[model samples]
Target: MVIGAPASGQGKTTVATGLMAALSRAPYGLDVAAFKVGPDYIDPGYHALATGRPGRNLDPWMQGEERIVPLLLHGALHTTAQQPNPARIAIIEGVMGLFDGKAETEGFASTAHVVELTESPVILTVDISHASRTIAATVGGVAAFEEGVKVEGIILNKAGSPRHADEVKRALRRLGIPVLGVLPRDEAIHVPSRHLGLVPAAERDESRQALDALAQRIADNVDLARVVKIAMTAPRLSARPWDPAAEVHPPVAETTTRPRIAIAGGRAFTFRYAETTELMEAAGCEPVEFDPLRDPALPPDTAGIYLGGGFPEVHAEELSANASMIASIREAIDAGTPTVGECAGLLYLCREVDGHPMVGAVDATAAMGPTLVLGYRDADGTRGHEFHRTTTTPAEPTMAPNVHASYLHVHWAGAPELAQEFCDATHAYASSRPDLKHHGDTEVGEGLVDLAVNVRLPGPPAWMTEAIMATLPGLGAYPDATAARAAIAAFHGVTPEMVLPTSGGAEAFTLIARAIPGDRPVVVHPQFTEPEAALLAAGRTPHRHVLAPPFTLDVDALPPTDLLMIGNPTNPTSVLHDGEALRDLAGPGRIVVIDEAFMDAVPGEHESQIHAEMDHLLVVRSLTKTWGLAGLRAGYVVGDPRLIARLAAQQPPWSVSSPALAAMVACTTDRARVEAQLAVVRTTRDRDHLIESLTTLGWDVVTPAAGPFVLADSHDPGTRARLRVRGFAVRRGDTFPGLGPHWIRIAVREPSVTDALVEAARV
Candidate 1:
């Protein structure tokens, strides 16, 4: 069951949470598992509090639609089969309204997206107060906007009076849509919203009261029997799991010896999805739990470490005061131990979190900030919000050898090999038992990794050759025939055509340079390193125009270049320039090439330049940095007839194939997924309070940051490396040319990740 609203605050969560609570206490002894559709942490908490079960987030963007059914089935079947219950149900709550998403139309991040993917009918929670008859138009628009999306029923929230409920019910019944329930306007039942949507139930002390009251209200008001009948009457699905074990990425090969993988759990690291931890277990390691706040020290048996995401900033004082644990963690990591830190975990591993003295594990300081750094991750494809209360300082070297730390929270595409290597190295130092002894280098702490399973591939994709070949094809033979076969041999996993290689974004630009020929070929500057480079390489003296100082483009400055090249949210400056303005600039005898490489960092697709419908407009997209597939060289140009034709002819046949094509098809085909990503972006933005904090610290911030990164001028004239010693690695302005050195580009990370930066930059 997917429950959602036209937008947030329509009471989808309240109704869903209430329903779960009511059912948990039912006489049926039903085993029910709750899940959220996107990257939400708050609603899941409410679900968990209501159901007395862990509510997993089933994000198709993060994992896949295949994983959705399997995860749901796994959570349901695993728990029910073990319990004394014979019946079970799974309830999935959604993000936004039905049919709102990142695509050309609504439903981009809408519950409708999940409905299509899961084959689940929607129970829309419409906020019906002022609007009455027009509600029909709203419902019709949602139902007709996309075919096959089932809006099986509607729940009228905040109905004015009993008469109002009757009127609305009669109207919805006329449309043949069932009005599941009508919730009266009860100020006593309101859930609070903070910077990051509604406050997560875990963080709310009154959540139990709210949930209990909500459940009683829903039980009293809603037709519980009808809902149960509707639920049972809905087509009974095969008990088969959504993602059968055989269908998921196979478990890693296990080692003869078990490695004790020390994981930071408790509340701080609770943000992690169960799949990642399960994968680690399947890989031949025993995951041990330790709280950074409560635990006094690392478990004596701990070998490797996995620190998933949670709220470190909220409990900064407690974490800071845990001196013994902090020292033990630092000692473990410093002594050649392998560690992976995500979101809050990343913040905890830093030198000092916020203004409080911390473990000093990594060589960085953390500080509090008032902005959120959020987005849908290009990796893992999960959409949810991230809100940690810290950021790292001297940010240049956020990564260290054995310890990998970043605010970038993703599940797949993570460096599993790095994890494997850390496990291998750590196990080398552990005390060897006769039964546990296996490979070389077994010692003290090293024994922990002996149990770990290594699932990482030996190297990156074979299509990684695109960037190299584009740069130095002459080093090898007439690469076509031999390179294709050699690529197949090298990968041993895929076909050659599946690897359409390019020379960075330069090759993509080269394709555009040749396709759009004219006396005036415009180059969008401060956006990417290559658009101008490619035009220059192609011998087209490109016309150039910088955006206005505040980072917004003055539409009047846009000249008709016959061929115009513009970057959405112009690159180095990280300005989310208006898409409509770029559309206005395109016309007859003109070709507009839009670089959307940075556009994915923003949450919604509506913010992207791809929305323009001009026949001459061509948009170039890259998965490199966004998805950390930079080494993969997977990018494509989307354009109208003549432009696509010209660009296609310039490329060799069967350019993009196996993996690159697969990853691309996997990413672009699902519009619901990308919008789901936006929830995360919004999460980061609200939690970090990045813009507000930066502005307070005297930095000029670009408003309405639609891109993942923000460009700002620092009050101080410190080199980025200088900031590195303090623990941050920021993109300096000099690399962007026309921008002065005082300017820096900060990637929107988790709130805790940005908080450290804010502290480091404190005036």
Candidate 2:
């Protein structure tokens, strides 16, 4: 749950950190994780002190929008790279006010936005010191400001007296909002402040004592048990924690002395990601923390120097007075030591910061700018951030010898290549980037049985070919897909407004990725990779729900998400899910996507939800597999009119070519249906024969195969190569999420072709 306020100075930080400590200690002993809403770094430090764990941030603006809930889950469930002590509950401290976000964006990165993404309950803290029933109006306004923002309860702070608290409570009763607590004004709870908000917990004198006292007072005043109930109301998430060790795959190096990497720290440089050090360790480097404000010199034998963002402008005199450290940094950079600096670190690399002397590595002078240069940045290839008031002479990113300095804050966890590349400069690491694109066509040799690809016909039938040639004369004008959309709608028994004719079934996934608004989108795996790939291309990281052996759709195992994509008579698995179960997954808050891409190949098209009237359910179909129209790229998505309109808006004008649109319209005709059913009958016979032959050879073949492909485990790791030697090509199964190399997806074909392949397998 989020601890928000009507505005700033409402005791949000004090109450939130206090609640975390109270929940984590004594009678409750409930594990608590702390999170800050925006990019502020001070409150998290105090939060860490209160919870005995690493504090984390959840800013949709800093990180990508899709990463907010995932990062929250990462911190709560994983805590550290080592996975020690997961938290039972998480409490988020909202930044500024409830609705404050990026400047002039109408609350984009606000606490309310985070709540909308996570669907967490909001515990608003209103300072009701000056007013009685008027405070009720302020709280009422916040509750009704947005339809989605739910003010579950309120914690009134700085109550002047019992009479004053009673007046606010009496007024709040009329609004039907529970008044959780009333904390009387106290100066001791307030921490010392600086220009950049509260002074960090590490720098404050008797900070631990102050926090403990604050926590006790909060426990005495507020309802701790009730707060836990509010936090529990947030939906349960099944997100896999972000692991730094898993993100970086470095070749095994000799277990000798680990390369020492100097990391900037202390009062002047307090901003740094815990994952950065974890990534360095994973990439075979020893991170040594050195303070630029106090440390006289860099760590001994420093092979790399990473200066993170902080307030160098605030402690300029102290950093400048540390002459030994400045000289060490300058000398190392002069010797071409690998070094990277960001924001404040960028300012420190200049000759002077606000007239204070500093390292002279880059030929520039740093001073305070008139306005803070802020906001998210991806202008270059690297996605980074710029949130500082300092400016530099001859400003664009400065590079000198082996030093690169810029006012961009890049989290190495998001882009591990930055860390690996930095380590590679030490001449000790190896890179082996994996490719995700699958190509069965490339696997097929010049003269092999055509089982690698799924298309039954090498080319389109005579009628589709004639249709393509006839459209060539009409191609001079812009393509129109109105006829295709109407055909798809008529065939599916849906309205034309609820039909979206796309270039291909794959393009439908791309349209959903671009148009659908969902921070939590999940793609069920061991299916086609297109949905996951499309989500990735559109700047969304989708969680893969891998099924066990003999893959089947399990809706309950799926993570909480707004957009859920799965395949029916699924691609490689060919496992058709229950239509009713698929429909049950779609409700008020979620939109279930059924990719019936191969359903047309099923005889009678059993277990299909194409005509379901559920507004939140969509069905996607294609003509590429059964009708042999892969090159023509004909497909459409059927759903509620609102969803179809959004997808159509994402598509460009005349996206579907005229010839492909003609094939789409043609495939919906009675003659096309007869041809597809006949082809499906023949394909089913071929699939049964192959399954029988493989089963006789002690192979583990998936049962009830409905599509043109059969997933079977030959129990031979070298089966693919041996088949290639025998003039047969089959799709490798390891490319899919759950299957291993021994498993292969063999395309159903003529019995004679299957006989030859079985003979080759018998050898």
Candidate 1 lDDT over 1-763, as tens digits, reads 7776777667888888888887877554456678887777667777878877777776655555555565666666654333544236777788766655544544444567667666777677788898877776687677666776767777888989989878777677668888878899998878887544666675577889877788888888877666666565445555466332332332254356566778887655556665555555544566788788787667644667778777777778888888767766775676456787877777888877777777666778887778776655444433333455455676466565777777766643123443345455545533221121121112113212210111112233344434334435343423343343334223323333223344335567888776677666666555565676666456444545655467667777676568888788566565667787787677788777788776666655565645324477766766664544544556656556566567767977655544454445434334425543754466445524767777887788766666656678884557454555566666656544346567666666556756777776662
TM-score of each: 0.52, 0.53
Kindly report the root-mean-square deviation of model 1 from the true structure over all alpha carbons: 30.9
**Candidate 1 regions off by >4 Å?**
80-87, 103-110, 233-257, 379-391, 412-763
**Local distance difference test values of all predictions, in order:** 0.63, 0.82
Model 2, clash count? 0
Q: Report the lDDT of model 2 for residue 733.
A: 84
